[model samples]
Target: MTYLVNNPADFVDESIDGFVAANSNLVRRVPGGVVRATRTPPGQVAVVIGGGSGHYPAFAGLVGQGLAHGAAMGNVFASPSAQQIYSVAKAAASDSGVLLSFGNYAGDVLNFGIAEERLKAEGIPCRCFAVTDDICSGPADKASERRGIAGDLTVFRAAALAAAEGKSLDEVYEFASHANDRTRSFGVAFSGCTLPGASQPLFTVPKGRMGVGMGIHGEQGIEEVDMPSASDLADMLVDRLLDERPDGAASPRVGVMLNGLGSVKYEELFVLYKRVSERLEAAGLTLVQPEVGELVTSFEMAGVSLTLFWLDDALEQAWTAPATTPAYCRGGVALEGEPRDDADLAAAHEEETPDASEDSKSDAAGMLAVIETIQAKIEAEAEDLGKLDAISGDGDHGIGMDTGARAALSAARRAVEKGCGAGTVLMRAGDAWANEAGGTSGALWGLGLRSVGACIGDENSVAAPVVAEGVVEATDAIMRLGGAEIGDKTMLDSMKPFSDKLAEEVKAGTPLRQAWRRAAEASQQAADATANLAPKKGRAKNHSDKSIGHADPGAISFAMIVSAVADTLESLHEDAA
Candidate 1:
């Protein structure tokens, strides 16, 4: 458990602040995450890598001279929002282009993929790739479906080295992909990690036993076995990795990283490494600069991951290149770049309010009330939501939703105070939720609100039919962005039912308030029904069997929000009457 923390809600942000303070010479704080304090050369590809916080050296610590140019840090065990990724990429971008890379996780895929598209739409050359190195996550034939683990270091390093050599975005992406393809990681844990303010660990291993194939995000392993000696454990890790070596490999040399997942100290790691080295040498493999310490860690998880990065001639060259970051360093790096100017950073700007009719402005106030209701509901139900998610995921859903809803309410209030229309208010609120929440649910909710806002223009009064249309638009936007259908056991399972019912009622000339109430009921039913279905997406999909009896946290949260909105709408109607 984490001992030092002010507010659990503010842990990620405060941690980032302290990290930037300590590494001032190596990194500078950006809006979303951190960037190298020194500027990159003109026309050099900017290598941006990131994921959730708690993995210290992985993200911010690697931002310096010859590694990641920037990292879009997110909440603990959550993907960074699209807005955050876009901001970090823009800040680190050079004349050449930006190359985005991260672990092959659902939230990261959704958020980073959106950011990549946004960059290209703005005419900035950009490409994104996900590292799939955890051999335990998927079958070898479906290697791309594997989650990234400690092997992220090799992929990030290779990309950064290519970028430092002034390669184009395409070349940088190629190098990262090659590194990912050649890398394999396998992990085990003696115990699970606890989030800040949590009373217990996310999961637990039995006494005198260890979990095999455990995930870094506090997920229980696929199997459990009696604890083995250090030498026996080393053989288990090294042999499993050796069996899954990349196909068509041309070299006997490999870059090894025996990464400690938080609580395991260097001494323990070195002991394990001794046996690991012997096993590799026995298998006729040569080790190159084996790293045996904390690299990519989960918050105080008593675990370790072994990564074998198969090195070809090209990869070996990049692997041996010089680097200087806060936590990890290679050979010697010449410091030639000047410090970046604060003013040159991409800072947030105040948005100008657009003209709107009195009716639209009044409706914007109503929208603010609904958002307030959502914020309250999410806060009240956060613990329950997290419990549901913990059954199959990292168990941060409740915290993420609470953070997002609060941000949305704050943004909606500000927009209404500025005399913005209902459309602009919802859009701003959506942006805030997406930016602050920084996960799969956050991105989808943000997109849904923005879509609804866009469908209901500021120039027109919002009627029952128009509201129904907006909801449909929102549902469509989520489906498009998330690529999930109604039965996928996501929020879409509830959202689709609510949207369709609302549209049906509106088409039948039902009152807006009455239609919304009915739709909210439908949403609740759908959410409850998800308990009978297995998850088809997100982290939960990995442990689908475990989630069979529990409703999806995303679906439950959606139901709660819509029901709260219905209550808020009824109250407003009663007051007006």
Candidate 2:
């Protein structure tokens, strides 16, 4: 179902109003969807930035005390009109002159250039910095002609800071050009975004696929490819960046950003970062600083963009300068460094020393038995979850979860047999899960399992009280890492309450078997309660109504499988007795 906006025709105006309202201390709109920071005094060389509204931080959110002086906003993915650009320029221009900056697109070039000429006629000096950084957006020979993506942040920030620092308009223009020269971006879309108040998507992508090099606004990409693991995607993006080699040093100071479209989860972003880091290191690139989040997004789109800025002292200083905006802000100079040495890498890759207890055949067998059961359950449910997911959300959830669980199970068995602690097993399993599984849910599941394994550690056996405490602790760990709290209609809603209940029962001196049974029941009840919860976070949040009546599949399956595991644990205890 489509969203019920006040009016489709006035959507851009209304959105701009809300943005100004929320950031009144920093921004105000001039005529035409153009906004300027309240602090920007007229007559200082002004920096005008813009393109579209949906990529929040892109055009407007980057306007702040130390950033752009103004932004011209367009509807959804459309380029801002020529009039909008002129208005913003007029509003921001001072005796010093004005610089118009935007992504390099045909529409933007035409409109902004028109505005530039108009500003000249008005006796206001103006220059333009049209950013083009996406390697996937164009061929190698014409890579500099590709569409702008996240790399615009670095370029714009450099120009804005220079202007704020009292640079002449010419100087600011040059500064921005240099920054653009050092920046490169690439992106992949799992699914497309939707226009406001629209039921259908703005574009379509096939299931279990990704449009590599897709533009932020649903433009056609270099090619559609089968979805790959985070590592694979990272490798592809990094390889492209390295191949193109943004202007400057053999080993440039790099700023990396794994930017999500509006609806991607933090968990998935982290997984992407983890792989990106590895690939960057292998390529002999130094990571100066990194940003990961939904900074620039298409409305409710499922995708990610990787932006790399080859840095210099000037660019580095500007990026670190404090500026508060709606969706983009950073403070303090970020200390930067290169990847670790080969010795460190080798040390990390070395085989682990075995634990004494794990040398026993029975202990190894027991661990295998537990993991095998978990693996079987995941394999069995994979198809069922996929079918359920097909109706409302991306159908990858089921496949992703199953893949994650199986990976975790495999890692756990191997670690345990190799005489590693449960904590080690969990950490290793988490890595495997993230590497093997696709989509957001896999990352969440991997994180949760890792936390649980860390809490359990090397414990061979636990009393009811310890088990209860461990479960509660695991829940807390998940909350911290995933950044999702209980009752957010996430997996934690079901897992946390049930674990707490288990602790309560154990504290009452209930038998391990009985406490587990109670926890299982609590888990089931909590999962059911999620059916009434409006999703306030994650992938499901996009469809507020669709998620309202249905239990979050992640929560449901987590509760069910955990409850079953607890049941098995109880049975094992009974058999031992």
Candidate 3:
């Protein structure tokens, strides 16, 4: 368990501040994360690595001269927001291009992929590679479905080395992908990791038992077995990895990583490595440089994982390259003084919005009140929502909703008070929602709000039919952005039906408030219906059967917010009438 914490809510933020301060010589603080303090050679492809916090040396600890140029840190066990990813990437970029890499998790994929698109849109070249190396997460044939664990180090190191050599983004990406293909990792856990401030760990292991093939993010292991001795555990890990060695390897030269996940100590890892090394040698496989320590870690997870990185000539050279970072420093390399401090790491400016007429601005104020209502409803149901998510997914939905709603409310209030138009207010709120929540739900909500605002425009008070159209546009945008269909047991399940019902009622000449009320009923019904659905997207994919009796948190949250909005709209319309 994580014992040293003041406020669990502020754990990550406080940790980052202290971490940057401690490693100031190697890294400097940026708004979204940290970038190397040492200057990079101009035209070097910047390697930006990141994911949720709590994995120390895997990310920020690896940022320095020859490793990652920057790390886009996020919430503990959550993906960094797209804005955060963009901020770090932009800060790290230096004319050539930016290559983003992270573990292949749903939140990280959505957030990082969006940031990459935004960077490209702004003419800053960006490419992303997700490290999928844990063999236990999926079948051998479905390697792409695997989660990245201890193997993140191998892929990120290879990519960063290629980038440090001033290789093009394409070459760097290929190197990373190759490294991912060659790397395979498996883990055993004696206990689960506890997040800061959480009373219980994400999962548990019975005393004298071990969880095999566990995920780093407190994802419960696929199988459980009787606890074994250090040598036995080591043999198990080594044998499992050996069973799925990369095909067509002429030589058995491999780089091995014995990773301690949080509570596991160096003594334990080195002891286990003793047996692991013996097993490899007994199997006639030649071991190259072996790193036996915590390269990546979870917070207070009593477990260890072994990564086998099959090496070729190029990979061997890359692996042996001297890279100096705060945590993993090797041979000396030339370094110029730090470049000029970034001018725009944190966005101090407001987003641009369309001009609004007086009536439109007034309506935006009304919308603000409606959003407040929605936020209150979310706040009230946050814990329940999280419980719903925990049934089949990471128990983060409640926290994510609270974070996004609060952020959106804050942004919307500021925009409305500044006399911004409705479109501007909604757009700003959407960005805040995505930036603060930092998950799949966050991205979907962001896209939905932005789409609605884009449809509404800024010149006039939104009519019922126009509002219905905006809702439909939001539904379409969310579907396109998240790749989730109506039956995917996502927010789209509720939102699509609500938008459709609203559109149908508005077309039939129903009053806007009444149309919204009618549509909200459909939304609630759809949310309730999700209890019977097995999730077809996100983290719930592997645990689809577990979700059969629980409604999707996203769908429930969307239904509640829309219902609140309907109430607010009905009250406002009655006052106007």
Q: Give the higher-TM-score candidate: 1 or 2.
A: 1
Give the TM-score (vs. native) of candidate 2. Answer: 0.56
**Collision count for each candidate, in order:** 0, 2, 0
Tens digits of per-residue lDDT, candidate 2, 118-217, equal 6798798899778988776557677555678888888888997888788888999999988888888888888887777767675678998888777776
lDDT, candidate 2, at 496: 83
Off by over 4 Å in 1: 464-466, 503-511, 569-577
Off by over 4 Å in 3: 342-355, 464-466, 503-511, 570-577
Better of 1 and 2 by lDDT: 1
**Local accuracy of candidate 3 as per-residue lDDT tens digits, 236-261:** 88888889988966677999889998
Report the CA-based lDDT of candidate 2 relative to the real structure.
0.70
For model 2, the superposed segments whose C-alpha errors exceed 4 Å read: 1-4, 37-39, 332-577
In candidate 1 the C-alpha lDDT for residue 372 amounts to 91
**What's the lDDT for residue 77 in model 2?**
65
On TM-score, the stronger of 2 and 3 is 3
Superposition error at 283 for model 3 (Å): 2.3
CA shift at 36, candidate 3, in angstroms? 1.3
Each candidate structure's TM-score, on Cα atoms with residue i matched to residue i, is: 0.93, 0.56, 0.93
